[model samples]
Target: MYIPELYKNENQEDIQNFIHQNGFAILVNQTDGKLWATHIPLVLDVNADGKQVLVGHISKLNPQGESFKADDSVLAIFSGAHSYISSSWYDHENVPTWNYLAVHVYGNVKIYTHEQAVNSLKKLVDKYEANSENPVRVEKLSEKTMREARGIIAFEIEITSIEAQKNYPKTEMIKTIKISFPN
Candidate 1:
C-alpha cells in the first residue's frame, strides 16, 4: 500500500481497532497471475503469542475457492470512515480535502478442509461478535444444510507483516496524526 507520511498508521492497536470496528472487508488474493477479491465479513483474532490472524469463508463453487492454491498470499482490506473536509475547515486558505482511515493486512492464506473451515467460522463468529449486544446469528443447518455448507471453503490469514495508514493529513496549522499497525 502506498502511504504518505501524514497518513501512515504506525500504532498496532489502532490498526487492530480499525479492523475490529470494520469487520466487513475485501479479501484479496492472487491466482494464475490474476488478482481476485471477495467482499466478506472477517473476524479479527490474536493468538496466545500475540500474532494477528483473520478468519473468513468463501463459497466453494466460487472461482476463488476453486483456484486457491496452498502457497497463495491474501490481503484483507478494511476501509474506515472518511469525511470531506473543505479548505474552509482549515485555518488557512487551501483547497478542499478529505479525512479518512484505512488499513491493509497482507498474509498467506492457509486453506482448510470443510470440517476445519466450519470450526474456524465458529471461532471467528464468537470472537468478532463477543462485544456486540446483538451479534449475528449463524443459522444452524440441518444434516443436509450442513453438508451443503461444508461445500463452502474457509481460510485463515496469518498476518506475516502489515503496513497501515490512518488518514489525517498535515495542514499548515494542524500537525499530522500518526498511527501504527498491531497496536
Candidate 2:
C-alpha cells in the first residue's frame, strides 16, 4: 500500500468506525507460492482483555480453509464508498482521479474450533439483525443448517497493524481550489 503522507489517517477511532461500517473485506494470504484471497464479512471484536480481533468464516471446501495457519500473516482489506472525481469538478486544471476510503488490516490468523465457529455465526446474525423489522435469530436455525454451518472453518485475526487512508491530496487540492476560484 503506497500511501501518501497527506492521505494517511492514523486515528484509531476512525479506522474502527470504517471497519464496522464496512465489515465485508477481502482476506489475502499466500499458500503454495500463490496468493489466495477470500471475500468475507468479519466482525470487529474486543475481548475481555481489551485486545482487538477480527472473526469470520470460510467454507470448509475452500482451499483457504486449509491454507490459513496459526500466526500466519494475513491482510484484510476493507473498501468504503468511492467515486470518480472528474478533473472538471475543479476550477483549476488537474488530472481526473478517484476519491475513496480504504482500510488495510494486517494480522496473524488463528483458526477457531467448531463451537467457536457457531458462536461467530451467531454474533454476525445478532449484529445485522438488530435493525431488521423481523430479525432472523441464529437460534432459530434448523438442525440441518446448523450442521452444515459447523462444516465451515471459523478463524480470527489478531490485528497487528492497521493503515487507513481517505484518498485526497488535501494540501494540493486546497491550493488548487484557491487558485481556481479567487474571491
Candidate 3:
C-alpha cells in the first residue's frame, strides 16, 4: 500500500480497531503471475509474543487461495465508508474529490491443517458468534470428514506490517475541514 504522509495512520491500536470494525476484507495474493483477490470475513488473533495473526476461510471451490503457500506473503485490504465531496459542498469553488478510509495489512499466510483449522474456526466463532443472544451452533464432523471438507483450507496470516491510510481531501473552499478520531 502506497500511503502518502498526508494519508498515513500511525497508531497501532487505532489501525487494529479499524480493521476489527471493518472485518470484511479483501485478501490478495499472487497466482500464475497474476493477482488473486477474495472477499472474506476475518478475525484477529493476538499471541503472547506480539505475533498478530489473522484467521479466515474460503470456499473449496474458490480459486483465490491457490496463490498462497505457507511462506507466501498476502495482503488484506479493509475499507470503510466513502463519499464524494462536490466542489459546491464547500463555500468556495474547489476541485471535487473523493473522501475515504482504508487499511492494508501485510502478512505471511501459514496454511492451517485439520486440527489447526478447527481451532481457528473455534476462535472465529468465539469472536464473531459469542456476541449473539442465542448460543451459536457449530457442526461436529469426524476427523476424516473434516479432512475431506478441508477443501476450504483455513489459514493464519501472521502480520508482518500494517499500513493504514486516512484520506481527507482539502475542502476549505466551502465548509470547514474537520478530521478527528475518538481519543
* TM-scores of all predicted structures: 0.78, 0.87, 0.81
lDDT of 1 by residue, 34-139 (tens): 8888899987876446877887888877787766674467888888777676655556667866667778888877777777777776777677667899876344
Candidate 1: worst-modelled 10 consecutive residues by lDDT: 174-183
Candidate 3 TM-score, true structure as reference? 0.81
lDDT of each residue in 22-133, candidate 2, tens digit only? 9999999987678989999999997546899999999988887787753388999999877677787675788987767899999988888888888889999999999999
Off by over 4 Å in 1: 47-50, 127-141, 169-183
lDDT of each: 0.73, 0.83, 0.76
lDDT preference between candidates 1 and 3, better one: 3
lDDT of 3 by residue, 1-183 (tens): 777788788888888888888899999988678788889998887754678888898876776666665238889999987767666678766798777788888988877777777777777766777679975634554667556546787888889888887757453454755444332
Task: Give the candidate number with the greatest TM-score.
Answer: 2
- Pick by TM-score: 1 or 2, better one: 2
Model 3 C-alpha RMSD vs. true structure (Å) is: 3.6
Q: What is the full ranking by lDDT, best candidate first?
A: 2, 3, 1
Question: How many backbone overlaps does candidate 2 show?
Answer: 0
Off by over 4 Å in 3: 137-149, 167-183
